[model samples]
Target: MASSGTPSLLQRVSGSMVVFLGLLSVLTSVRCDEQVPVIMWTSEGISLPRQPPPTAGHIVGHQQLASYLEKALNIGPRNVVLFLQDKMSIEDFTMYGGAFGNKQDGVFPNLEEALQSSSSSLVLPAVSWPASNAVIGQLQDQLETSPLYMDPETLSQLRLNASSPALLVFRLPYGTGSDLLSAKEILSGNDEVIGQVMSIMKSQSVPYTAIYTGLQPSRKEAASLSVEAGLGGGRSLLQARGTHRDRWRDRERQQRVKEKPGVYPPVEFKEDDRTCMLLWAKGLTVSILRNNRWEEHDLTPSTFGEGVSPKLHGSNCDKSKGRLVLNYENVLGHRSFKLIFVMSERHYKVSARRWFTLDAVELEYDGTKARFNGSRNIYAPAEYSYRCKSVTSFRWPLLIPRSSKDPANQWRVSFDDFQIQGFNLKGSEFSYASDCAGFFSPGIWMGLLTSLLMVLVLTYGLHMIMQLLTMDRFDDPKGPGISVPQTE
Candidate 1:
């Protein structure tokens, strides 16, 4: 309360103080926010000898790379924009990769041409820099003759923008000129392009990245056995050896049984019942081979601009009785190959039985739904593990039908992303359903709004009636009055 001139002065002073305190609180809050721990960003790059092989792993397969990135950058794949670079041959590039291969094709161009079209940074050729060196020399010479060249201004801006965490993939894609260093000699080379690549990155002023995917070691295994690797016609070496051994053992067993028939009743036995089946990921594309015709399932929509490849997921097959099954049709020229992978998804093919079913595909061990994308890549590797259904090593036993024309080519499926979720007492994946929250939660909000509208309508009607009655008594020219009430 204000008493007089003095009180008024106090009030004015207090009001100014309140405003100052509020501003100070806000500034302090902002200062505190800025003081929180920040991530120390670093940039690095990877240089591989050859173009990476195609990965049959599914969308979840990216998680393996993501894991490494997370460890290096403290950021996941979804949060970072990775720049993957490599060189490919003309034919292989266009046929396998969606990117255009030759400059003559006109539709696609080299890095220099691409820069021109996109209005991005220009790329210049640099001298060979050894991989061991931190930066390259003669950077100034590089800027003058590059097919696409970036000015000093553009380089500075890009460097600042790339200061955040990211990953870089470089390839000494050029053939060793005349040097014949095999894949085994991947890390060797004094004049390899990797050095130049690093130097160019520094001059451009982009943030640094770390080596992620590389030509370090192969995770795939090769299946090998002695009996003349053959086509549809080959010797059954394993079965033959087993049969011979059985015959020799039987002769001895029979003699004993004949001599001791009285001691023991003739023993009877039954054959063990077990089988194996093929199971791919659910919704995965399948190619059925019949009469030289192939029908594929789950075709990608053309509107997507690029098509995805068939994903290799965990198979949910009959695991109790026999070996797993697959055909060599997918192989271009090889009869047998190794499969190395991690068990992203694992199940009993059923809740209890070994016969795989759709139910297995729908649930994770913890009952979460998995989202699988259909795509392929070069650097990604299938995770390796010891689960019965995974491709863990190069040497695996695959049994094919004696007759290629056998009927019923049905493939069952279950899968894990190798990096995300799979394999448990009851398998399931963790799925994010944020969109559903808005659509579903809106119904409750709408209901509350409707209830509020109803209350407002009732209150307005009563207010309108009271206002009309008062107006009639006060403003009407001829209106009845309560004289008795006034006298009282």
Candidate 2:
């Protein structure tokens, strides 16, 4: 009985183990999810009151504030203005303002003194309201030109104020994650929020300055009064603006992709048209030898804008003369690269085919042009019966002459899955015969011989069977008087 129950007991033990492991994994995943939310600063804050203070003039968002600082403070090219919102906790202040006091004490007595002593060079400044419309208009104009430009609807929603804007400035080094390191220095401070904000700024490569407001609830009525005499705000307005700009750039890129030529139907060209020849490839790729390996660059309409053109002035449809030239301003960091295809008609039996002979491939680097002229041919059927959907591919190597300078290196170019259509065709669509070898392969010949041999073997086997005759023996013991009659 013990032996019979051993397998069942082991099965239950294994099942229980799996269940425990699954529960443990679930708990671990939940803990990871909970840790994902960290303290981060953003541009979001309460809107300014509509009622203007006696000393206030015009209300503006952080963007306008940054612009005003740029002009008023004469901010250098390397310097930027970053803003922080008012009414932040002590920990938040310590993180942005830089490390001050021991963790055990946890008290900020003189914020101004601490800010001055901080590594980030924090400044507390009370910016008086600009009463001049010209100044306000100029600031607004600068905001419009910025990559983080706000829409007109949001601009109209901005309220006017008579109170001066309170600002806390951090004059830190202008490199990636410069301010984040200041926050990180404090062992007990929460640097996650600032880390997230700095990541956004660093990715966009945008310079920024921060304005941290130290406003309190008791001073809400007196909006124009400065907080703490010199204490700065703690929020990041540029972080949110950078995110918005990233989305805008994404939309523009998607629009450009939609407008690319090959995404839509091919343009039609008249048959026997002499003015323009319709010759296009789905893509043009150039391969360059780098670090003992080849690196490929695919040229698109965006990269080589309107650079693919055919030389049709001297091209004659009747004479089978055509030339395609591709000029790219930049390829693989080279100054320029030019590829020319000299095309003509080749007659095979009763059919004529369009053929492109590679004339010259040149690469311009450091003001010197390296030209490679090779005898390579690409051909397709000339008749329109071959549909444009059919594509032909060609790949070849351009070996540098051994006698010439760089005999050790060889350059290769591959033209893959492209069509050369509209030579003397009715439409710009490419037409080509499918690449196929006629029924003369060695495999086909072998199959035919094998089938013939099997048929001959079967015929001989049947002939031999027909030649054999069976002997008949008659029993004459019982029936003595049996007479056999034979008929011819």
Candidate 3:
């Protein structure tokens, strides 16, 4: 007989291990891109190092903020793809900085420097300084162009992942009022950044964002920006911090309290009188205490006047606690101004100023309970079994103005302003308990039928195979069966 020549079990196992490692090396050897594509635009000529009179440290710099964003978004080091606007050339910009340098890192200068050693600055348009409109328009144009608009590697990853591009504009306004580039200038110019961005979002279907970073909240400007973002189905983040002194004090107190034992702050919002409502032309102001802090929400025009009828935007029920957390906001408004945010009363301070929580009105019917935040007459439909908690703040005295000089009065209430909750009166009407739903379509039915048919066919095929295997191939062993019976 021929000698057995097969390899031993150990040799076979070693071969398979080598093959697996070789395949893994081939799979992982290719360079995979992990960078996030970020098109950045910052206002030029604004002294990033300038110090404010009241604040000890300088205002937060754009470059520093950008660095924080990179870390927040998980962008890889040395892999942040940047866009050089205003005809910036690589020679004019630096990926590195030093002592004599501009004290800015990860920044690109739009204009070329006269001397390689001298400081570089961004080139502005002839029309004005920090023309946000022009920058945004040019960005839109670049996005429409070829993939060369971004780093080659980053573009490859974008194509592979199939992600739409985004914009991040950082502004430290150089001028005041009309000269400043902001969302307020929407209709002022055809090519204005806000308008153009909104058009691009609608026409090209892209994401556009304007990040406002400052030391204080510019309420009016922030509101306008928020409106712009809402129209475009995007986002607006105001990263403004409180007064420097206040922030420092908060940090210190938090640390001290955490370090000390048996020394704790009191919860003040738990009191019944803590919750209060302030009526103003802007909207209804609801104040509540939470975690030793005063939190306020303004139910503005978009929610109450000339907007969608007040209704339950969404709700969450906890059967175990018999409690429901309802989210109320204008149909078209931003989420920041949720009319009702919490149920359990709490209080917190702002800059050492105490503010109380607005108490919720409770109502019970047929063993069902409901609580409404603030004193408002708006109620959810009874069909929803939403035993709405009525607002205790609404009273006859509030209707009569305290003084003629005062702008706000209870008489300001109207159908448009008063009705803010949804109520279903018709018992026959049906609605979704949750925001999501499912449906059975024709395609689904067709697929199910096809599957059943395939299963039946497979079962029949298996049965036929078994029957064939059991059948006698030649004359059966019946001839042998006869002899076996005699022996038995």
Clashes of each: 29, 23, 25
Q: Please write out the lDDT profile of model 3 over residues 1-488, one tens digit for every residue.
A: 00011212113332212212211222232211110011222222111221111111122232333333433223211111222222111111121111123434312121111111111111111111111212332332333211123332333344221154443332222112454333222212212333333233234323222221121122234333333322122122111123465456547755675687644321101011111111112244443435665455454433333323333222221211112212243322222223332222212354343222222432211111223434132212222222211222333221222233221221122111221212221211222221111255557888999999999999999998888755344454647433334565
- Candidate 1 global Cα RMSD: 29.0
Q: Give TM-scores for every candidate, taking all chains together and pairing residue i with residue i.
A: 0.24, 0.29, 0.17
Backbone clashes in model 1: 29
The reply for model 3, stretches above 4 Å from the true place, is: 1-42, 46-190, 193-311, 314-342, 346-488
Output the lDDT of residue 386, model 3: 22
**Candidate lDDT values, in order:** 0.24, 0.34, 0.26
Error of 2 at 193 (Å): 54
All candidates in order of TM-score, best leading: 2, 1, 3
- What does each candidate score in C-alpha RMSD? 29.0, 30.0, 31.0
Give me candidate 3's TM-score against the actual structure: 0.17
